[model samples]
Target: MGKRILVVDDEKLIVKGIRFSLEQEGMEVDCAYDGEEALMYAKENEYDLILLDVMLPKHDGFEVCQTIREYSDVPIIMLTAKGDDMDKILGLEYGADDYITKPFNILEVKARMKAIMRRMNKREQTKEEKTLVKGDMTIDRDSRRVFIAEKEMNLTAKEFDLLELLAANPNKVYSRENLLNLVWGYEYPGDARTVDVHIRRLREKIEKNPSEPKYVHTKWGVGYYFRG
Candidate 1:
């Protein structure tokens, strides 16, 4: 079956354009005009990805993204106004996997979305059926799930991907640029700070103390590495 996607935006023209573009790729597309509607569609169906605009009629994209993080790890890409750097960072903090600035070319949008989808699909297919246990934390590669003392961790797609990569190669320090290229895909145009944001969030979810993390550690000038 073709990939399922949800495209949300208050502007009907933008939504229509994106929907048409995605359909051309033979993917299934669903549309939502506001945050409330977007949340409802997200809860009702399983989508391979979501394209959400930062501005909406109700709740806003940040709130919608944060709320959805409660139960789903479905990849989300935020659409932010051009020059709004804060919007991009805020979207990541709110659990969006990626973002596209306004005035973006349709081709760039498709390339970015396709890159994320392809990377996720490739990883899901290539991962081996095995589990890694470290200090009460369990990582099941087969299920792409993480647990602490047997309680499942509600991780976003990028968070899980970062953690799994670090855990799989303990003690190997990966630079921020390296991680961005590796986990976010080489086509991603995000800066190194994106890696920092994800690492901080991952530590908060999986660490006993975010300030002095046990599982993920920073190497001062170099980058981050997993201790387990």
Candidate 2:
């Protein structure tokens, strides 16, 4: 079977269009029309990616993203009607990996999906002898697990990926766009706040004091990095 994807949106036309287009690429497609159904479908099965609509009924995309982040880190690309950057920021803040504004071209959607899928597939390639340490925090690239102060910390896949990138290259600052491209390795419309949110979450889990992070540190007007 080809890559599997879940498309969530209230608009039947949009859902049908995406499903059809993705299926043509030989991808297995699952869909839901509302937020509740989306969440249910998400909880029931694992997919390579999720295309979630931001303005969904019942829980909305932000709510569903936040809830799903509690357990799953399947890459999520948000669909939003508003072109506002703030809305895009909010989606990313809620854990979406990417975003597309409404009235989008089918080809554009396909390109974004392919980009993210390519990165995912590339990362799936196994590597040996890569482990990073930042003070009390330890990261295992092979296991994709993190330990802080000798206690394991549960991290979503993307969060772990972000931490791995920074912790592995301590002292090398990364701008939001740089992190988005290198870490996500895709063209995402979401802004820098996405990186900020993940960093905050990581600090909250690994730092003794999130406000004064001893590991992940901001570079004033630049971006973020890690320190021993």
Candidate 3:
């Protein structure tokens, strides 16, 4: 079966052009012209990737991306006409995997999509490993599930990725930048604070004492590591 993709844009010509290009590559493409319609289609269907435009009539891409992150971790690539760095930062802040400026080459779009999908496929394969145990914690990568002391723990997509990385390589220190790149993808334009937020949240969910973490430990001025 061909890969499925959703292309969201207000410009009919742009959407048509993208759809045609992807279709030539044997991809099944879906189109949404506005933010509300995009959200509706997203909720009702399962898509491998979402190409979303930043400017729209109803809700705008940022709002759509934020709302969707509340429910799904499907890869999203934000499309923008503005050349502002902050817009790119905000897209990553809202859980987007990547962003592209407007007037982009169609070939580049196809290339970027292929690269992101490859990373996602590699990640899914990594998740096929057998369960990992750390003290009272159990991480089942196949199902993307985590349990502490026999009780299942709820975690967002980013939170799970952060924990999985640290736990998989116990005692190995990872700087904020490292975590940001490995977990959120290299195209993400976030800072150290982003990693801090996810780490703090993960500790709260897994540690019996968030103030003094047992499994995840801060390495003074270096970074963070997981106790094996």
* The 10-residue segment with the lowest total lDDT in model 2: 183-192
How high is the lDDT of residue 114 in model 1? Answer: 88
Clashing pairs in 3: none
- Candidate 1: count of backbone clashes, pairs at least 3 residues apart or interchain: 0
**TM-score of predicted structure 1:** 0.87
Best by lDDT: 3
Tens-digit per-residue lDDT, 17-85, candidate 1: 998998999999999999999999999999999999998998899999998888787878899885667
TM match of model 3 to true structure:
0.87
Which pairs clash (backbone N, Cα, C closer than 3 Å) in model 2? none
Tens digits of per-residue lDDT, candidate 3, 1-228, equal 899999999999999999999999999999999999999999999999999999998999999998888788898999999999878777877788888999999999888888888889998786645788998999988777899888999887778778889999999999888887788777344457767777888899888899999989999888889999
Each candidate structure's count of clashing pairs = 0, 0, 0
Sort the candidates on TM-score, descending order.
2, 1, 3
